[model samples]
Target chain A: MNITVLLKQVPDTTAKITISGGKVDENSVSKWSMSPYDEYALESGLQLKEKTGGNLVAITCGPERTKKMLTDAAAVGADTLVHISNDGVTDSTHVQKLLAAAVRRFDSQIVLCGKQAADTNSGSTGPGVAELIDAACVTLVTEVNYSEGKFSTIRPSNSGTEKVAVDGLSVFAFDKGTHELRRPNVRGIMMAKKKQVESITSGDLGVVLDSSNVTLNSQNPPPEKPAGQKFEGAEHVNEVVSKLRNEANVI
Target chain B: MAYEALDFYDVDSLLTEEERMVRDMVRDWVDEEVIPNIEIACREGVFPDEWRVALGEMGVLGAPLKGYDCPGLSYTAYGVICRELERGDSGLRSFASVQGSLAMYPIWDFGSEEQKNHYLPKMASGEWIGCFGLTEPDYGSNPGDMITKAEDMGDHYLLNGAKMWITNGSIAELAVVWAKLDGVIRGFIVEKNDPGFSAPEMKGKHSLKASVTSELVFQDCKIPKDRMLPGVKGLRGPFSCLNNARYGISWGALGSAQACFDSAKDYAMSRIQFDHPIASYQLVQNKLSWMLREITKGQLLAYHLGQKKDSGDWIPEHISLAKMNNVDIALEIARVARDIHGANGILDEYPIMRHMANLESVKTYEGTHDIHNLIIGRHITGIQAFTREA
Candidate 1:
């Protein structure tokens, strides 16, 4: 079995957000780091590789900077990297197509990705790739256990926790919780220096250029709320109720 | 302010992928594990003994050594590792430096195969903590003139020596003690449990407070004759260990400098004065620019030296140059950082004064800054300066 982990380079969440000309001014970002859920997904892929003897490769659709991100993945545990050279392709739909093509090229038995990217908050790529490649899809999966050619996945359900089983190959969209991200060991990091990362252009993946259907809209900062009047617990309950009905007009 | 490891000259690009990863990983580890606890540790004068397992798990102990389940990273990687560790606190870096370069290196470099097989693996896994015993009560720079002696008993060696300023001394399971054996300086692997051996904590030290420093006393300490390191004789054994340690300090000092510079820079930029950020002041910019300039030079020196170490063409004097230069700049940068913070720099809330005080020890240990200049001087002059006074 061959496992593949998908990673994305997202701006550090703690960065102060600013808008310029209807889009985020990326220059305001202090740092770029691995998305939190993708890190969990990578951990899942590593675990899958460890349990089932096979190479775990990481492939990402990112720009030149993501090369380091892929190498970093290798440093943590990935065996190899295949980068779908990012040429400013922001369309999530196109990214899914490219990922599906690369998954086919590697003949991966299992492909794992985060349920949602932190930057875009667009959660379509996981199931989109699964649909494109005709593989079993598990979304919002929190835990996965592989035993005897079967995957036992655990995810949250309205009733409680839910367990689902999938046979053989599948695409997993992870939603954090449970997995502990392993730090890079010295030996793996050293080997990462020698690990070859195969690069493929979008054209080689047969991804056709098309005008993105989405139109740019003006970006604005969220509206600031008026300062709320503080009540002195039970003593001000009557006043609070009157304010909510008269001033807030919520009654 | 967000502290990114200063790669002022795009130095990370020059580093190998593995090296960069190793550096960044250690940095992340320190930030997550050490930063929150370090201030209290320093204030209380307690070492974070709790982190020993993580440090060992991280392969920080003897990280450059191969085998014994060690990480065996490059020297430059090790340098950057020290840089990252010291950025949190120099005492933390000293703990690692003394563990790897001082304690483990002597065993790996000089111990017999049996000793190596026994100790190296355990040390790598943090199952055992070790400290080096070289600087004695009467000896700091001049170890050759020391009086600590190991007598050759029929069944074992009766080692009678006292070592001072030893890191991890009180907590170590083993001590790589350097003592005179029959008028010849020899290194001994002294276990802390040996009879008549004691490591007493030296208290009230204001500098390097985040580490354990003690005096190792041996009142006829007995150990198996086989425990003596068989590889080298005389001061060369301990001097070589010191040389290895100095290499770490070279980068460790730069880490201290980077921390101070980060605090200083961030404070200047955000701190309002005269209705404008102090960073807009010409004097503040001058200080920061100087720090940037010196730190870049130090980075280049450490990087190139690491490359030389990896290529197997390294010399000790180059390490001396780096240690001396980096420490000097770091202490200066810390003072300027204090100036930038005005009054808050002195508080435990910031790391400037802590690093400043710790650099005083770093500059002195692993060969003093002046001693390094003399070491470089000796290399250039081809003449022994110590004998000129004689």
Candidate 2:
């Protein structure tokens, strides 16, 4: 069983962002690393490939500079890499269509992706690709097991939890907080340089999806969260709970 | 300007991919195997004897020297391995340096082919541990005033002397004993099982508690004449080994300094005082900036010196300069880092105190800070200032 993990390179979460001149300042972003959620997807792919005798392919959709993430993934034991070099595409629907067209050329049996990209938080690609491929889709999946030509997925649901079994090939959008990512050893990173990385262009796929649906209105910094209120003594617990239920309205 | 341009020297790039891989492997091993047990080992004041064979299996015993079952890595990579191992504990790095630089180097560089073939492989595999016996009870900084002697016994040589502060002496299976044979200093490989040989542990050591230091006594010890090193015969033989160990000290000091700096930096950011993090204060920032500057400079110096050694252009005076600069800077960084931690720095919970204690030994061992300064002074002024008799 050949596994293909779709990884999206996002800015490091620990990076301190600065806003100046009505735009995000790139100078403040010091280092580039793999997105936290996508790291889980990469770990899952490596684990599955290690357990089953198969090849693990890492696919990314971004600009040319994003190849570093692919190279890092290869260092962590990804057998192959596919980079979809495109200029600009913010619409989730357009990205899904493009990736689906490109993935159709490969012999991918299990497709894995993060639930959302950290930059935009648009959790629509997994379901979109499942729709394009006409396969069963599982979102927010935390655990996955494949045996006897079937895929068993465990994921959280609105009503408690749920488990679903899908036949044949499938797509899974893994949620964060599933498991801690493993650090790659030096030997593994050295061997990764020799791994095969095949770069594919959207034009080569012979399909141009419609990207006219969405337009960028404005990009700005998110407002900082308010400092949390501290409570002291047993009497304040009742007040805090009341405020959380009535004033904050989160409970 | 530009946040004082804090330098995290890119010394790692000087190494080849394979060499860097060896460095990273040992770094991981030290972090996993050594760091976790360091506190316990230091508290017990006993070295982790189990890691000897394990470290040998990892190719650390004779990592840089080529041939005879050694790892054959570059000098830069060996420096990196030393730096990482010392980051966990200087005692651990001391074990590797003594085995690789002091003991194995002499046999490989000066020993007969038969001697090299006999001892190098066993020492490399950790099947036999080795120590270099050079520092005598009377000779610490000055090695020329030695009284240890070896008398010719036809087929065998009778050796009589006592060596002090010898690392790995108590546990070593073989010892590379340096003694004066007919007014000429030479190296002789003496097995521990040899008659009239004894290594007793030195007690009451406050620093480098996790390493074994012993007094090697050779009372009429008879060693085979063939074990005598033929290529080197003089003070230069042991001085060259001392140079090698000092080169490693240049890099090892940086590891301890970096660890202290990192701890202090983290503590300053999170530790609260005056209703705000200490990092917000200019005074704390000043201390941190100073440490960063020193660490950066020391790292760059060690890296370049390692490159020089790799290219076979390194001089003894150059090594003295590096050793002098890095060890002094490391001791200062440890002190400032401890001051930033305030009362907590005195405790072992923070590594500043431990590093502060260990740097004491690092400063004194191989060559003291004052000795190295004299070496640099001699190079500049064309006069040797270390000897008052002259």
Candidate 3:
């Protein structure tokens, strides 16, 4: 089986975000890392590939700096790396079409990606690529098992977890699964420095982008939280109760 | 809040992408693994036995050595590993230094191919713990006067000596024992179970509490002829190992200092006094300013030293200077940080006192501050200041 994992590079979760000129100022982001949820997706792919025995490829879309995430993915056991260089932003559908082309080129039997990118939290790429490629799509997957020719998966439903089986090629949008992401050993990091990433433009994948319909008006930082009121001494007990009951709305 | 390393001089720009990756990886690991348990380990006065395997799996045991299942990292990368580990606790960095630069480095540098192939792989994987035995019970600053003797008894060598203040001594599976044979210092690989060999753990320590310090005793210890490290002999063999370890200390001291600075700055910013935060006070700012200034200089010194070492332009004098200067500054920083924490610093809840205590041991070990100064003086004045008339 051929498995492909979709990865995205996002600003490190700890980096302080600042805005300039109606958009997030890229320069203000000091560090970048693999999107958190994508790590779970990659973990699921790696575990499945370990038992099923197949080629594993990690794919990402962005500029040159994003290649670091691909290297990070390779360190943890991605065999082939594909970089779709698209410095310009495209609509979600166009990006999905580009990813679908790469998935088809790799002849992937199963595709795995994060439920949502850490930065945008759009959660659309995995299902969108699946629709474009005409493959079965499963979201919020927590567990997966594979047999001779069938794939068994467990995903959360509106009420509870539901077990589903698929017979054909499929895409899985993973949630936090049973397995935590594995940290790459030093040897893997050293070897990853030598792993080559194949960088190509979206045009190389035979995909064209149309103008996006979405527009951003402005960006602003979240409002500062109000200072917490401190209640001290027994004399203020009734006042605290009144505030909790009336203003805070908690009894 | 996540931990951030001090890089005020844009030192990250000087490093390669791979180097940055190494720093960040080890930094994250230390934050997750070492920081949480360090205080408890210190309070219990024992090194976490489980860390050996974890460290080995991370490939930091013999990180800079090539082949033999080693990670083959650059000198800078190794230095960064030391820095990050020491940021969590100096004892942790001491563990890596002893295992890598002291114990494993000599074997890789001076042992036969068979010895290298046999021990380096196992040591790298943390399957077998190794410790270096050089500083004798009575001879520390002057190891040349060590009384340990290894007499050649035809097919085997009989070794008898005692090494004190040895890190990882009790838990080590193998020890790189240095003893004089025919008045010449030679290195030997002694197994833990060798006849008449013992490593007794030493209890009680106000400093480096999270590490296991012990005394290695060898009484009529018998070892096979082939166990000797044949590639080098004389004081050069052990001095080379010390150089490697001291070089690591230069970088590691900065880590401890940075930890102190980080804590001091954060504490001063939030610790309110009178009406404003303590950070607004001039006295507090003075201490923080001194720490940042000294740390920045020490970082530059360590970075340059690493580059020179990798490029083959460095000498022992450079290492001595760096070790002496960085450790001195680190100890001062710890003191300042402790003062800034006011009584809260003494508690294990804040890392200030632990770091302050650990830095004391660091300043004294790997050739004390005064000894290194003499080494530097000798390099400049063409006279060996460490020697005296007999």
Best candidate (score: lDDT)? 3
- lDDT, each prediction: 0.87, 0.82, 0.89
Instruction: Give the Å error, residue A131, model 3.
Output: 1.6
> What TM-score number comes out for model 3?
0.95
| Model 2, docking class | incorrect
Q: Which pairs clash inside model 1?
A: none
Candidate 2: global Cα-lDDT?
A: 0.82
- Candidate 3 residue lDDT tens string, B243-304: 88999999999999999999988999999999999999999999999999999999999999
Give the residue spans of candidate 1 off by over 4 A.
Answer: A14-30, A88-90, A167-169, A206-211, A216-251, B312-314, B377-388
Q: In candidate 3, what fraction of native interface contacts survive?
A: 0.55
Q: Pick the candidate with the highest TM-score.
A: 3
Better of 1 and 3 by lDDT: 3
Candidates, DockQ: 0.46, 0.13, 0.59
Against the true structure, what is each candidate's TM-score? 0.91, 0.73, 0.95
Candidate 3 has a DockQ of 0.59
Question: Which DockQ value does candidate 2 get?
Answer: 0.13
Please list all clashing residue pairs in model 3, or write none if there are none: none
DockQ order of candidates, top first: 3, 1, 2
Clashing pairs in 2: none
Model 3: residues with Cα > 4 Å off, grouped in runs:
A158-160, A232-251
Off by over 4 Å in 2: A1-86, A89-200, A203-251, B1-41, B46-73, B84-88, B103-131, B144-162, B168-203, B210-233, B265-289, B388-390
Residue A198 error, candidate 1, Å: 2.3
